[model samples]
Target: MTITIRSALMKNFLGDSPDWYKWVIISFLLLNPLVFFLVSPFVAGWLLVVQFIFTLAMALKCYPLQPGGLLAIEATLIGMTSPAHIGEEIANNLEVLLLLIFMVAGIYFMKQLLLFLFTKLLLSIRSKMLLSLAFCGAAAFLSAFLDALTVIAVVISVGTGFYAIYYNVVAKQADNNSQIADDSLIDNPEHQQIMEQFRSFLRSLLMHAGIGTALGGVMTMVGEPQNLIIAKNAGWGFVEFFLHMTPVTLPVFVCGLLVCLLVERFRLFDYGTKLPEPVREVLKEFDRKASAKRNRQDKVKLVIQALVGVWLVVALAFHLAEVGLIGLSVIILVTSFCGVTDEHDIGKAFQEALPFTALLTVFFTVVAIIIEQQLFSPVIQFVLQAPPSTQISLFYLFNGLLSSVSDNVFVGTVYINEARAALEQGLISLKQFEMLAVAINTGTNLPSVATPNGQAAFLFLLTSSLAPLLRISYGRMVWMALPYTLVLTLVGLLCVHYALVPVTEWLTQWNWISPPSLNVISSVTAH
Candidate 1:
């Protein structure tokens, strides 16, 4: 009897331990998100808790936890896997989703408006190449200063809008069959209404604009992602940054133009319509509306131009003085408020950045941690060790391929850091490095619209804004991008080789005596 009683007690004790353990896990899960509000302590949740338990149980049951290289991964896994309050997990994930949504929305909305204006300008000017070149120049400059994504968003929007107006309003009025189609369609149509009126030729031209803007981004350190990473990692300043990247940018742009021209020939198949009369009518409308509304648009443009000019000056000053991005932003903001741009707009820009900034920073920080841990060092080093020419060539190829897998910005940031390391280590010089930057930057963008999974915010933005008027399709966009990609890659390759490579090779060869610290390890650590 005594033995039976003792057995019962033991069973109860064992069952109680599990109950207690589960309760404790539940408590931690609940408290995890709350920890973010607390500066003093670290708590984690999400499916993290569940994963942690599994990892711990498996590791303990199956193997030993070793210290060293894998420790960081182990820590991350553990923290991320640890059980958390389901509520907290949901909330955190929701925040991330919201951030991503905002980022996508901001870019799309901004691009639509910009595109509208560019189309207006094109209608007034009626020269696709001219518009394209101007756009490319602006894109290149902006990419060199602000981030490429932002520049692209703005430029693409303008391109889309400019043509939209010309086609939807301006082109239709002047077209040959347009009047009959409009009258018949409204009264009683026999055949489908032909909507082509604006410069259908310019449709292909808009494709070139994207190509040019993307190519231009490769020209300078500030132009795109990989370059920025390279600058920071390679300890490059402005003069050095541009000098190094020119090899890639120059060739890429030149070749890109040729390709764009060629590709545009195929785009000419879009022979849907010609210069319409309505485009001018619409411009007149815009002018009247704008003038009546205190001529806000014209005034805004003037202010925008001046602010941009000042922004550049202030940015350069900061760079020269090494005052950093903060100083530049302050200068831009102060000057932007000078009877031109509204303070509200400036604030909006900053606020707009906030949505994704923190999340992106965290992601990069984690990646950086991984690098510091040396787990990622091997892969990066392997890529760096490849010939600069090969790296430049392969960078575009791989970037284009992988762009279908992730966000262009994400790919860009990773590539930049990796390329920077290569530059610093002498695996690639600055010029060679820039060549790779250009290739990858352009590559990432074209493929972004390859599918829903790959589609970027810009793609959606374009569709939503213009679908009502132009009736472009998802399939059409993909098909359109195909010709774009083919021409762009070919032209981009040519441009990089022609413009940047020779100079880069010369510089690299001359600097050989100093023997660049080809190994990124030395720079990051005291070793």
Candidate 2:
């Protein structure tokens, strides 16, 4: 086949002088992280298409490799010509994860407005302590559950206005309200020299929020996409998902509340002096506004209150009714529209959402196709064929790692599908999968905080969000998150192990089926 192609090329002219180096460069460039984190979010299988085209161009068109050698071997592995699609598959998982994030963002906005109303209502009562804690707690909890990026988008007072808009506008508002001694930095060049410093600060804040969401996601399927991916892969849908996640979410919510509050409360950032006097004054003023904002938020509060109450029930209806993503989104739109408790309040929820929203839905379509085709079949095959324990361990480990640069929800679901396929084909067992899902899913939260690549994390990094306000960091996040990760993972691993692994006969004799006693959770090995 090669000889014939070469002969034809020679006859056709110029083929004998093809630039082989171009192929090598193509291979390297196509491997860029842009696919996993960037293009996939917007165009779905576009990244996979890049991979395949590069592989083919390098191998066949460029003919850079010999007939049979090390280069040939590498080419074979790299030359993924399958109609199957690893890139799209990965992307699809990301889409589902994005959906959950949508809910997170939607809910975050709801929370802010509602909290504002609540605080306002408390004006005649104990609005000081209780109202403040209540609003902050509500914000933190949502941040943990849906990815803090959701909260950051609407909060523009730097850290204080972490839920506002036009941060510059808020800054001007603060300038007007606060009685600052007028720092010269607003007119000085020294403070403005390092744009990177500003960016890094934002990145740090996002990292914390990312960690929060990833951890929070474990609490419920709506927390993020990985849960849905796992459920879909298992063919168990909503009931199964809620069953697996709710118990974990409730405990994590407590953990999340403390972490978010303590971190913000302690003002670990420069004893709360990192921000300028003007900035500080602005934040305090906004808190007052936020308090005032909550007072008028009655309609929003009612809608969200009902949303929390009916979230699980409404989600399950999608499954019982056998509707897909479009159907589910429609349900959300319709219900939200019909229930327009505060038509005058929350603004148009899905207005700016449609473009990003379309991007999400179509992107998943591409992902579904890739999974169907198995462009990544070779690697996936290796992972699935490994010993069940090894596969499970790798799944969770990779889940944690990739989530740093990519969406964990997408990565985890892909792992879930691979694990499920293995189990159904008798390559592994359901019991093994159950444990694997818990370990991997629970660990998925770490990546959310480690990097700004995540959808939730990225939004959190907006110049106006907490990233600049808090000055978070990659290194700092690891330290901040280690305790949470170790605690959550250990508890999660054991819960999953109990669920997936058969109880030893001796243990069963003790009537130990009560969801692993609290002592049992605490005793699990962090390592």
Task: Write down the worst ten-residue block by lDDT for model 2.
Answer: 63-72
lDDT by residue for model 2 over 382-446, one digit each (tens)?
76777765665556566666665555544565566655555556666555556566656765764
For this target, which candidate reaches the highest lDDT against the unseen true structure?
1
* lDDT of each candidate versus the true structure: 0.46, 0.45
In model 1, how large is the Cα lDDT of residue 120?
55
Per-prediction TM-score = 0.59, 0.55
Write the residue-wise lDDT of candidate 1 on 316-360 in tens digits.
434644323433443354344434365565455444345444434
All predictions: root-mean-square deviation over Cα? Answer: 13.5, 12.3
Q: Which regions of candidate 2 are displaced past 4 Å?
A: 1-149, 152-210, 237-239, 246-348, 351-391, 462-466, 469-527
lDDT of 2 at 155: 35
Q: Worst 10-residue stretch by lDDT in candidate 1?
A: 60-69
